[model samples]
Target: MKTPNPARRSERSRRAILSAAFDLVAEAGYAKLTVEAIAARAGVGKQTIYRWWPSKGAVFVDAVLSLSEDDTGGLSLPDTGDLRADLSGVLRAIVDEYNDPRLDAMSRALTAESLADPTLNSEITARILGPLLEVTKDRLRSAQRAGQVAADADLSVAVELLYGPIYHRWMLRTHPLTHEYADTVVEFALRALEPAH
Candidate 1:
């Protein structure tokens, strides 16, 4: 049999480790997740994991990135030409995903990891959150160019206004993030951005 390239084997091992880490964290919570356990679950040696990821937190961040595949695809907000519909649709999807038990747990894990390690937090932001936010900002800028949004509106601030409340509610567990709630958010944001009478 032809020998598999070492790089290919290494890539496979890394993917397995990340997948195992995500499943373990999702099922057992981050507090209980460890590199040894992840290595065992992935059927790879501990040294393999250590060689690829520096720490459990690094593994967890990789896991989060792996699990975010679906949410991260498309990455850009929909520009349906109707700003209201586009923003509402995107926000609704985000709210739904935010409320998912698995995603919620993963998010909580990331937050905890961030609190414990500033480096991990920066890594996560640069790799995951930052890309997502950049895509959102691009969509908002598109809306502005199309005259769907006001010219003077700050796209970054506007995107934050649309998403900040949803994150606040999700993190605080203050209110249910239902479709109705999403609709209300879109309505309020549109009203605030509408041209002055």
Candidate 2:
């Protein structure tokens, strides 16, 4: 029987700590979550967590990234040549996930933390949100190539238009995030992007 390498064991411990941190936040909210709690839940020592993550905020961000991977299944957007349908499908899926209890908890916690700390805000945006937005832009660019969207359509603006409203609704709790809302967003966005007569 060969002994496990120390480096591999350390890496596994780190992953476990991050996963446990996310689960704790999802269940108990970030305010009640602590490094000691995560260490115990992860079956690792408290020093181990402190050695890697500088603060609970860093651990929370890592956990959020992990949860996002589970949610998005790795960020390749759906592009079936029909711009409106593709955008609608993607956005609706996002809305559904955003409304889920686990995701909502994590999102709210992160939002609160971001509001308090500019560094955390920048880290989350750069690590989690930016890549997702880039994926959206890539899909819209594909639509442009297929002529479903006008050549001059601003992909960045289009992506923002598609996702901004959904985020607004989620953050504000203004209305139910339904497929119907997604459909309306797609319709208005597509019309706006259509070539001028």
Candidate 3:
């Protein structure tokens, strides 16, 4: 008789665990989510979750990422050579995403937890926000080459300029996040990044 494929079983279990984590967080919020609950929901042993993830936060990050995976499996920004338009599109999309109730709840839960756990914060940065930041930086670099952005402009800070206000407004609920607001941010960012005379 052929031996059972342990690797396949492991992958299946991992997928199940991630899905369970996502579902639980969406249904009950992050505060109510627990490793034990994930195990029960996934039909796997608690040890199975521990074997792969260091904490519930890690599993949750992975779960959220898995659900948001695109067909390209990468966070891509539009690059139509019109930097202003591209930036507007990206920021508007971000506003749209943040406007989603499920995503808003999930983001708030993760942000709250990360404040208390430095390790989880690092994991969230590396696994969730890191790729998107890198992609945005790359897009800015392309704009620099196209002479749309100042050659000496600090790309890191430039990225912040584009996203910081939106993040600030969203986190603080200072104002409603909308596409028009996103476009306004893009306008300000473009002005700040305008090529030197």
Candidate 4:
């Protein structure tokens, strides 16, 4: 008999689990999410998820990343030459995701959970924010190399500046998120980081 392709089955299981996690979180919020529920929705045993992830938070974060497909394999900065337009386009895409109600619900749930669970807060960053920040920081370092950003720019801080305003509005509900707002944030944030000459 031909040896069954275990990798293919594993991939299918992973996709189902992630899709179930995302749908459940978007529908019920993080506070109510459980591994059991995900297993039920995924049509897999709870052991399947545990084998792949350590906790529900990890699963949820992975699920969100899967749904968002943020392209984390490398620093995904567009290099069409204009830093402003490139950054604006990146941030605008982020803003567009925020505009989606499913993502909005999931983000809100993740944010709320982070507030009450210090460990989870750290977990959230480790699973989601850490990779994203590193990629963006790498992108900023590329800009520095290209003379689009100041040589001495603190890339961590610059990356934060790019995301912080958008995160604030998204988390606090202080204002409507829009492409205009994201572009404005990119403009203002880059002003301080741009080459001094």
**Which candidate number maximizes TM-score?**
3
Error of 3 at 12 (Å): 2.7
Clashing pairs in 3: none
Task: Compose the digit string of candidate 1's lDDT tens values, residues 24-67.
Answer: 98888777888889989999999988887788877777777675
Estimate, for each residue in 45-133, the C-alpha lDDT of model 4 and write its tens digit: 99999999999888877776675546442225676767788788778877877898876766777788899978779876886778877
Q: Report RMSD for candidate 2.
A: 2.4
Candidate 1 or 2, higher TM-score? 2
lDDT tens readout by residue for model 3, 1-197: 98999999999999999999999988988878899999999999999999999899889888877876552123458789888887887788888889999989888987987898898799888876777777889899999999889999998899899889999999999999999899999999889999877
Alpha-carbon deviation at 125 in model 4, angstroms: 1.0
In terms of lDDT, model 2 sits at: 0.82
Q: State how far residue 83 of model 2 sits from its true place (Å).
A: 1.8
**Residue 103, candidate 3: C-alpha displacement in angstroms:** 0.9
Model 1 stretches with alpha carbons more than 4 Å out: 1-8, 68-76, 195-197
How displaced is residue 155 in candidate 3, in Å? 0.9
> For model 2, what is the error of residue 140's alpha carbon versus the real structure, in angstroms, after optimal superposition?
1.3
Give the lowest summed-lDDT range of ten residues in model 3.
67-76
Stretches of model 4 off by over 4 angstroms after superposition: 1-4, 68-76
lDDT-based ranking, best first?
Answer: 3, 4, 2, 1
The runs of at least 3 residues in candidate 2 whose Cα sits more than 4 Å from the true structure, single-residue gaps closed, are 68-75
For candidate 1, report its TM-score: 0.84
